[model samples]
Target: QSEIPMQKPFQQVKELVMEYPVSENEPTEENSYLSYNLVVGDSLDVEKCTAFEVLDYVLLSEPGAPLKQALLDAGLGKDILGSYEDGIYQPFFSIVAKNARPEDKDRFVDLIKETLEKIVKEGIDQKAVAAGINYMEFRFREADFSSFPKGLMYGIDVFDSWLYDEGRPFDHLKKLGIFDKLKKEAKTGYFENLIEEYFLNNTHGSVVVVNPKRGLAAQREKELEEKLAAYKASLSPKEQEKLVKDTVHLKEYQDSPESQEALNTIPLLKREDISRKAGRLYNTEKHCQDTLILHHDLDTNGIGYLELLFDTKQVPERLVPYMGILKSVLGYVDTENFTYGELSNEINSRSGGIYFGVQVFGNAWDNKKTVHMLGIKAKALYQDIPFVFRMIKEILGTSRLGDEKRLYEIIARMKSRQQMSMASAGHSTAVMRALSYFSETACFQEKVAGIDFYRLLDDLEKNFQERKEGLIAALKELIHYIFRPENLMVSYTSDEAGYHGLEGEIRELKAGLCTEEIQGEPAVSVFEVKNEGFQTSGQVQYVAAAGNFAEAGYHYTGALRILKVMLSYEYLWMNIRVKGGAYGCMSSFRRNGDSFLVSYRDPNLRKTLEVFQKTGDFIRSFQADEREMTKYIIGTISELDTPLTPSAKGSMSLNAWFSQVKEEDLQQEREQILDAGPQDIRNLAELVDAVMKQNRFCVIGSEEKLQQEKELFQEMKYLL
Candidate 1:
């Protein structure tokens, strides 16, 4: 194991420098960004260097830290990024300023440097340090270990310890010791000294400044094609034949079935290990006032989770897009009494977090009905329940919507984040767009916050000056219609005592909301399936083809769930990911009977769609033995059995309630899944055949690839 020396903290320093212009696809009106990555080029000794990790966490978590304050003052947010290994730690600070001019780049860099220097000289605030320590302690002690597979986590920790040559895997006692050591070290000037040695005076660092440049994508594409052509020309005939042979061999290997012995060798949960009974179920109680309150009693240490779901059925369809805007900016903008920064600090210091979003779910009782909720979720300690209530009230009642500068900043930030997401999660967006065609809820979801939402945001950002008044007025109108006590449904999760104590406070808060009643339900609109292609700068494509079985009178069954597992593991994995060179692929079946076959980070769009279209044939021909069926059954049960954190569990329970799904329904579903067999699997093949014939699909990919097959799509759009 790597050891840490008690003395001589200054080590060798190395520097790596690189400069790159931004891509042609990125918005480059005036924004340029700089990143600094300070890496400790040494292996960490977990036993001895736990204090160091804690110190790093403290520095990162303290929102009131000098460096963070400085960055915020410069209209930038400090995005700290890091990874740790047995003996290596790499932590860096990424400061992004969306509206930065070229002239501001050097000033931002100098400010960052000066902030570090100040940290080295004066150390962090004592109150901030205390808060960090408290937060870390709570995280360590109150973490939900059941959220993931305990056995898998244990095996990973053991393997890591063995790889590092540590004596043993970490346990509760060892962890407590580390925490104790961290507390002691935090009281001294230890962190300041470490910062000075490792960062302030250290010469080992790199500064990466990325500036926006037009046409970089086209230039790079040309260079790549030239390189490929030259490589092809240089290849000998024999070498080319051998390369073809190697590719054929790889395809064959991926297609070949694994030996029984090999399959048995893999770690898997046995059927006996699966529980037949439902796990812990929440005890739900409802209270009525102007709004309905749904309460779930679950042990949450001393923490409380509160959620307000406002019925948005009364909101006009035209205001749906603004709901997304409101969700993004509501808690982020200034309130009547506090600036945005002050609100942020207050929330961080007093509570865990407060946020808002719109949630759409298909109604459980009625097939044609869908529940549209504007949800406000917050978390806080039991003692700070009043503060949570106050914060929620302030956000809903006094949040400034007409602050044009702040509004524009929020739009720019949201646009930037969405653009970044396209490169990584385009598959999700594609699937959402494809599914939007089948149902009113799905269509509304797409318009509100899917790929269509991104386009709306882009237009708003580019033409903000022209559309400012209309946008603000629309937002105000949305607030007027949706933010009413009559439309509210309150839900909370906490220990029994905490719930009882905060019940009256919550009731008082609900009573104070706007008492005006909504007159009528929002008009629902129908949309046709749009077989579209979205062109982006992403190197790979995200392909999705979906069909709503419910619309065709096909209800969700356990057979469909089992079929999903089989197709995802065998058919999709082998065809699209393993053989087609995609990063991943999945087949999802929703309870609402919306199913999607999606390929992620895929190299081929048309070919991936072809593979999806052929799924029916694959399902019809699939032959699985008893062992294979048992394995899939166990896998499905394992997924169903995965535990959730208190907050997550509460939210899930509330959603189930909204959907009118009872515990009995879930138990029956579990039984159905357990009883699923070969016949059940065979029955789903016909459904797959039907779905493929419907031919609803969407593809998001590079402009080059998308344009190459534009004829395959009904409409083509550019993301940028």
Candidate 2:
């Protein structure tokens, strides 16, 4: 009796537009980072200009918005595309107004800034925010991790899939996704915060204004071309050959005294520290004071570690990333410095030639010796202070997508080798573990690991031809990926002279007592700060904040936290991880006395500027939004409730029973999550923003990128 009707094939994409006027600033460094444009003119025909709002940010219009054509007739530019680079992810804007007077620059920036402020002040439409939140929730709830690989691979191929400059595959993928029922049974309440996190912290975003600096632009382009050339040469021989044939005007480097000098400085690991607890190894050390504290975790019949870190005062900042790369590279390539093929050889030799492997940050790095490799883990060791800086640089410097070529090559070899070895009954986990551990130790996090220095030399040799374009393209993505504004570390610190620069910058607290009818009844008060500086400073670049209050008794003989939710994260990683020798480190923080300090994991006592700088930067930069909160909350909650495997649960329960982490602590941790609100987050954001402006960052990588990018390092305040 019922007829099923087909639904329409298309749904309307809704967009909201907000427009405002802004005054142009003098292009100071402080505001340079904010995308703004400079326009030159003798006078303003304010009536014939226009502006636009793209994504969530403001933009001036050389080209007005499609629907805002009417507004452009009143005085705005007609093009918004000038400020944005095609194919990049960041939100951007442009400004071009005709007949604007030379004196109008300041007025323009001011007008635009004011308009932006008004937009922010007027706030996001609650209804819109809610609908977006709900839609995201629905999408995530319905997402199937199973389809991720196919979807992601298809998306990646989009960059190369164009035929005759026309993109047909994009539509095909979308249609197939729906028609083939890959997107069916969609749920609407999963983790919507992933999208939120992407929007707020992606590196693709930038603010661009037209500047009359041809020299600067040219210099940037030249440098970029060189960098690009260097990167392309690092791929495999097949890829490299392809790049050469496909690209043009590529430059290559030659063996030069400058590079030689830089290469000579990287040092070898010279020490180790070991301790025992409860009949198991508890601590391990390497490369100066870098330390790792091990806990015999029953979960994997292995260990978990906590790293205690220090600043980079003991090491060079330039060397930090270089060393990391070297650690990874040296672990693999048979080294001239050591006989027996470095650690892999050593393990196979020790185990009568079995298999070996190394793992970095949970990913397989040296899978070649999988047969003889048993197990290995390696991560950088640094202090909490500049940990953020280290993370930023490390993520930026390393290849994204885990260098899929390397992955495939290593995997294929391992698979084939494993098959042959299995036939001989020679494949043993012990042998493999030994090899992996050895590589993990010798080559772990070396500066040269991910770099194609040899390729750069090859590119340099080619004299800017045969593979320049691909190299340049790769370099652009790598540089932009690493240097995206989202990676900048921000933090707060009082002046060494003892000035609380942030004290009055934020709104004062509005704490008041609430009492019952009884005159002596105890009461509670609500305290909150207004814009003494929340969103203004821009230091707390990643997170948002806000606050609110409810009635409670103040004199009820109960102590309350003035700064209830002071937040901190695992700052730096120490040598808690070692190949075949140590495990990963875990840090714990418990609220203590007046000022607080928590557990840290790191070995080196190297407390340098890089360490402190990065730590503060990370603290200042990280933003806690709904998505972050959801992921963290969900992941943690899931972990907490996860049943210990049959073997581990009993021990975990026994330990919890013995330690103070029984039901109460667990309940408290959960309650902390429940008690959090949006305003409290906003308040914390402001505090972080205020502190980050004056902080310094330290680096501690190797000789290569650092030496080559010294000028880059010079851009920041460096100590030693």
Candidate 3:
């Protein structure tokens, strides 16, 4: 069956390598995407499937994708992409040459084939393969999908076993087991053979060419109908009858509902098992070498988690943009001790990972104040703390900031990624833009990681040659200013054994850091919002309106979280998505009194804003039955109890301390969420109304849509 999978289709095809070109893209899409995909193997073969995943990481990921690099050198496309996809009944492999022309179709196919053949003849990089294995192994141990519900993510991982092979629901639950065997097989010829057997020799595949288009979906649908009709006509009468029956059964299954008895089989958390009090972090603050240190003694399986947060107050306003740029390039450029790739490999081999980012810790009780800092987070085995600290010192304190070419490459990549993510994350971008009008906390966020940062990246990418020397100079000076002993604060999470060696390492880390003291007050970056609209090439608009309730004399409450659930799942869902034809909408009320009501992929901009404006009315008149209230309280609790890694816990504690979110506040909020009533939500309606009345808004949509609502915005321009 496997040998002849594509034989029937092959009979009607004009070529073994088929090309089905479609002259269209998503509605109003500004750019075209090119993809090359083929069915390789399935999840049923665990060893081979896992090997393909590792191979994809080595050959297709950033920091280097050698095969994709070859394609880029050939000028076939602007970006090269390839990957192995599993966790399904029939998994496939895909290689895309972004921005490549239709004529380069054959060139892409040929290049992929030749590359595989060359690698098969020669050998793959053992070190890279090991790094790939280590990478996934560490992630498996971490078991942290901080962005999503842990149980839901686990279900996603386990579905392959339960859905595909119900005989063993927990078949794929053991990920590390697969990795252990894979590590041994990788050092042999198993991966190469797997590649040849699935990718090189597999013929059950098709080529798809997608051309850019706007407002041509109807034409594409009609073409699909004609082709489908022709294909159906080729079938025998009995075969066609079976196809019709099968389709009817499929639809019936999709519409089917489980019986109440079957539903009762699912487990529920009893009230007795639930914790009444909130979880408290293990934070023991002290001082060492004139640096503030917060230690979290937690079980980490011999792993040490350390966070270095240096206050950004000393950074001059002029250096803000450069400091943001430094976050993207540090730990990713050539250091005096190691090249970026080598350093990455070494880090993976010995430790979990070393990373950098900018953080804004706004006091939950006071929006008027914030703790802005540059953060470096590292995790490694207790045995390897010395190596991790050395690596951190090298990258954060002495990275080669003068390499213009490498810096340009990093910024360009950053620009590409930011642009790609902007399409789906426009709602978030809009919120940041809207809140920057008044909220200093949002101002700092937007400067480092939001629209302001994107603008900086855009300007730099377009004119890097002219901006190179000065930008590098500013980054160098800012890095020095940031890594000083005075600004550095540390947080470490580990067993006592991990801390046993941390004191000496902390001293060494501090000694290597800059000791300069500024003579005067530290400068701050000030930002002003334009109340602008960003015109994009999207079919729908991301409409957002935000304001801080603190200005309205309102404070944060646990009831706000319950209201969040109701609005997100009920009010906004019904008004914006179900009735208004938008994809989704949500509202957020943070402890700092910042709030935003936003719609995702909304069609009518004016209508969405009107819906947002009426949200307070919804909450004021809101009523929930006992069952519904219980469900919402449970939902809020679910969010509050997200599974956090040890490292993540340490980071959270550090941020909480800086933000003034104390243990009593957390426990009080938990109790409030648990015992919340309809009145609790209703009482906040006045605050919501006052916040919405501020009328600070931002919209990111197609140029046509933005033009239609042009009166709403003070100014509008192209987002990218």
Candidate 4:
């Protein structure tokens, strides 16, 4: 054997850099909006710039800051105000303003440039920096680590640090010191120096503008098809045969069963690692006057999470469209004693966030009963509890909805956001629309966020000048029904001391709201939802099929959940993603016994649907041995043990209490999950077969694909 010459790490890195030369500007006219990105040459090393990044976020776009206000005034309010992307070789700053009116693009760019020059000359306000530091500190301490495995988070940190040649990965102690140092530096004008040196002085930069042109998506699809056809024609018959063989071999390997001895070698948490005891439930309910209070005491490190749920039973159905917009517009507009800017700054300084939204949950005792709530959710420091309560009162009691110019601006901005969401999250949109046909909760959700909601927003945006009076009246009516004391349910999560300290203040706040009883039975209206496929100009496809098993008097078992995991990870992944080239595919089982199969960023709608239909057969034929069952059981239990933030824990407890999901029920579910065998998976295939027989589905995809499979859908609609 001959020894090969080895290259040093630096040489290897240099060679790699030379292989992929950075492009100054990649031109594109494919987008439906005018998108701009201004990139700077200088690198902001991650280890050093983390604090400055946080500080800069506050000054440039912190809700009601001057820069953001300037953009809003310029009709660029929907733009992504300020965001930075760090790179290893050369980091760059980005100021993106997308979906801008063609006529306003020039002015928008000029405004952004002017704002940057002013910041460079005058420096940021010290008060803003201080508040930003406080907010950032709170966020760092309350970081949510429940979505993924803790070990995965740690691994990612380590890998990034190693790749960037930065310092060691951060831990709780290390982060505290880092935040303290950053705050001290921010107060000393360190961010101003960064602005002048890295941004103002750096001449090496590029301005990329993506302008929209009609039929762009269609043209691109045609070009792609032609290119693929040419490539296939160029390939030799032997090469094509080999490619097919390779694909089949790969699928075989993915579906192969592992032996018990082989599985034992892989690293995993054993059964002993799981705690047999159920999660701690910490909610205590009390009544103050007519208002209901759900409180939880947890170690929150001197932070408080307060959420208010106002019953929306008395809200008239006519005002539903206006109620949909209330959450976005409420805290963002002027109040009686404060301008919108002042209110934004006040809330940012005292709390993590103060947001309002609509929430719906099924009643525990009667699944047919739907609880529609308008929720005001907020989080604050223990000392700022009084201010949080006061602000909530002001927002509910004194918010002015009559500012015509401001209201129009808010609606326009909301329309822009919804359009963007429709493009990127079409899969979720399709699933919501499909599920809406079968379940009450799903129907309400669709009315609020689905295609119907998008249509309502579009009409308001296009005909605002004509519909102004009706819109304002509807908003005012919504406020009247949703802000009464009789409809209030308050829930708070904090340390024991924080809860006791704020109890009196909360009671006083509740007493000030209207005491008139909301006299009505909950609104119940049956809707005849059309089974439809929606068309969009998106490049990819999203397909969803959902069925309501509960309504059919069938309930989900632990075996069905296990079958879902197997189908999603093994069968669907292999067929829809690996072979068919979708980005992702999943089968989800909801607590309400509703199941949905969704394909994300898929290329083929008809093929993906075929794959979904085959799931029942796949599950029926699955022959997992003892080791495979153990592996899946362990994986499921690991998810159950995932840690949640104190605030999240409190919310989960409250939801469980309200839903009457007792500890025994959860324990039994866990047992069923662990005790599930291969036979159970085969039995659950019957449920999958039954669900597929309904022949109900909704797809959001390219118009070309929708037209090709028009007969598969009962009705077809265009999203944009």
For TM-score, the strongest prediction is 4
Residue 382, model 2: Cα distance from true site in angstroms: 31
Writing each residue's lDDT as its tens digit, candidate 3 over 445-487 gives 7777777788888788669889888888888788677888788
What's the alpha carbon RMSD for model 3? 6.6
Poorest 10 consecutive residues by lDDT, candidate 2: 533-542
Q: What is the lDDT of candidate 1?
A: 0.71
Ranking by lDDT: 3, 1, 4, 2
Each model's C-alpha lDDT?
0.71, 0.26, 0.77, 0.71
Clashes of each: 2, 167, 0, 0
TM-score of 2: 0.20
Best by lDDT: 3
lDDT of 1 by residue, 1-720 (tens): 535332333254333333233434556755555555454433334533444454444454332345545654576532322223343233333334444555565676678678867776776555555544555555555664656755566566555445444654453224666656656776687667766765566655555555666555556779999999899789999988998899899888877888989998877765556777765457466766555777778889888888888888888877888898888888778899987755655665667667789988776544356888888888778898888888888887898899997787677768777766766788888888888787666787887878878888888988999988988998888887887777778888897788766657757766666766555657676768779998876568999999866666667776677888888888898888888899998888777767899999998989998899888787777677777888889878867878688877887787788787888878887888887777777777778777777899999887778889999999998766
User: What is the lDDT for 121 in model 2?
Assistant: 42
Residue pairs with clashing backbones, model 4: none
Per-prediction TM-score = 0.86, 0.20, 0.85, 0.88
Candidate 4, residues 551-638, lDDT tens digits: the string is: 5566767666676677777888888887888999888776666678999999898888888888889888888767677777776776
lDDT of 1 at 223: 95
